[model samples]
Target: MTDQDTLDAPRDGTKEARLVAALTGKGQTLKQLSALLTWQPHTVRAAMTRLRKRGYVIDRVAKTEKSAARFKLRGDRA
Candidate 1:
């Protein structure tokens, strides 16, 4: 399937599915995702860790110590 199609596909009602949808495009920050998902920051980080374990490439762009890190799905999936 195409990347966009893959992103759009339903994920069996898992939180990861929602996270995938949220991060499909430009991605989001821990705070943004936490707010969007109604989850705590630690919960968001844990979810992201799980996503990585599932073979999803999540890229983190660090801006500054005080700024929240930006995350995006890496396009180069084998």
Candidate 2:
């Protein structure tokens, strides 16, 4: 799949939610989650994209240039 397609790839909805919840307390980027799960970056990216499209994903990027990004659940909107 193309890069965009890869990002848009499908994943289990509930698992994606769990992943979001797990990442909620702390922020986690797609790369971070990929490294944490030992999965490919694209896999994590895909999950992120799919979750985001479903409105179940939220990411907290660092406000400053030096800070790292994080992942989280987007309030009750999920």
Candidate with best lDDT: 1
For model 2, state the Cα shift of residue 4 in Å: 25
Q: Model 2, stretches more than 4 Å misplaced?
A: 1-18, 63-66, 76-78
- lDDT tens digits by residue: candidate 2, 1-78: 122323433355655545655565656766667777677978877877767775454556565586557666554322
Residues 1-78 of candidate 1: C-alpha lDDT, one tens digit per residue: 234444434467777788887786777888889998899999999988877666677888787878777887777332
Candidate 1 residue 46 Cα shift, in angstroms, is 0.5
- Clashes in candidate 2: how many? 4
**Poorest 10 consecutive residues by lDDT, candidate 1:** 1-10
Tell me the lDDT of model 1 at 50: 77
RMSD to the true structure for each prediction, in A, is: 4.8, 8.1
- Backbone clashes in model 1: 0
Candidate 1 TM-score over all chains jointly: 0.72
